[model samples]
Target: MPGMVALRYNPILKTFGERLLASGHAPKAVIGATMRKLVHMIYGIVRTGVPFRADFCSQKLDFQDGI
Candidate 1:
């Protein structure tokens, strides 16, 4: 399902899920969070009229101190 795909390929969700697992979160909780994330992503794409772009989706944000 989409949850499986997100776990395998969606970088943001994949990393988030892994971190939650490492922190001792339940597997079902992780999967549910990932599914919610996927839904939000789909909604954003639909609202913006932009095709799903894996490259864009996988980009990591760089945070600088003192914003």
Candidate 2:
């Protein structure tokens, strides 16, 4: 699951939703967006042959050359 955050109004969600709309996403597209993120996370684990670790963290440049 994503990092924890308290429920509160945030302009980013509106902005993101607007972008999704512009890209032809329907009102229920949030589910798809979330699923896509999950798929990416799973793909990352498989691509690197690594199991998920709670403390896992890396910068994009860190693996530019492939570990």
Candidate 3:
């Protein structure tokens, strides 16, 4: 799926997935989270008519209380 590929090739997402795994999340959970994030990103792109940028988020958004 696209989420898997994103986790494999997208540096930021890959790091996120890896961190989740390290934090004791199951494989399925990681994939589900990844896909969920992809959906949000895609929705944002469609809603705003903006192109995707890897650094669009940068450090402006940080996870709190997991996710």
Candidate 4:
């Protein structure tokens, strides 16, 4: 699955998945959360026309308001 592959190859996604599991999320739920994060990251990049930065982990994105 894309989530599993992301976890294997993407350090950011890997950490996210691990954090979710540590918080008592199920395996499937963690995968789903990672997938959702992947989609949101892609959308944010495209919507903002900005290059992706590996070190970006500041705050939650407010995509609804176009931020």
Candidate 5:
């Protein structure tokens, strides 16, 4: 449910979802990947003891493969 909300409302994930769809990926696969991405992001924040920041997250996404 959180992943679905992120997919709809979060700009970074929204863009990533669009790209995946455009590349012929299945919708379910895209959602699964987005969910994984959200988990990774959450892990990073917890590990760093920092709050979530959209700008910082998007910048990190820039260097990621296929994003």
Candidate 6:
């Protein structure tokens, strides 16, 4: 089932879909959003040498007592 939807599309779409899936996004408009995030992540990692941290995502993280 992995790559099932992507395999049907062109290389561009496949790449977009995979990026979308990797970024925890799944929806009809995932391609565009994923592409944008990919650009930002690439700049952050390559230009700044920083790893992507889920906790620092635009979506705020939940804090539990006594972590």
Q: Which model, 2 or 3, shows the larger TM-score?
A: 3
Question: lDDT per residue, candidate 1, 30-51, as tens digits?
Answer: 8887798789889999999989
Which candidate ranks first by TM-score, i.e. highest?
A: 3
Q: Report, for every candidate in turn, its global Cα lDDT versus the true structure.
A: 0.74, 0.45, 0.82, 0.76, 0.83, 0.49
What is the C-alpha lDDT profile of model 3 across 1-59, one tens digit per residue? Answer: 98899889987688788888988998989999988988888999999998989887746
Q: Please report the TM-score between candidate 4 and the true structure.
A: 0.78
TM-score of each: 0.71, 0.39, 0.84, 0.78, 0.82, 0.38
Q: Write the per-residue lDDT of candidate 2 for residues 1-67, one digit (tens) a residue.
A: 2311100122333333345556676645644554454567679989999887533443332333211
Worst 10 residues of 2 by lDDT: 1-10
> What digit string (tens of lDDT, one per residue) describes model 6 on residues 1-67?
2234443443544555655566676664564554554566568889878775544542322221110
Give the per-residue lDDT digits (tens) of candidate 5, residues 1-67. 8778889998989888888888899988899889998898889989999988777667666566673
Which pairs in model 3 have colliding backbones? none
Residue range with the least summed lDDT across 10 consecutive positions in model 6? 58-67
Off by over 4 Å in 1: 53-67
25 in model 5: Cα distance from truth in Å? Answer: 0.6
Candidate 4 has its poorest 10 consecutive residues by lDDT at: 58-67
lDDT for predicted candidate 1 compared with the true structure: 0.74
Ranking according to lDDT, highest score first: 5, 3, 4, 1, 6, 2
| Ranked by TM-score, top first | 3, 5, 4, 1, 2, 6
Candidate 6 pairs with clashing backbones: none
The C-alpha stretches of model 2 lying farther than 4 A from their native spots are 1-27, 55-67
Better of 2 and 3 by lDDT: 3
Please list the residue runs of candidate 6 whose C-alpha ends up more than 4 Å from where it truly belongs after superposition.
1-28, 58-67
- Candidate 4: tens digits of C-alpha lDDT, residues 7-57: 788877787777777768889988888899899989999999999886676
Decoy 5 TM-score against native: 0.82
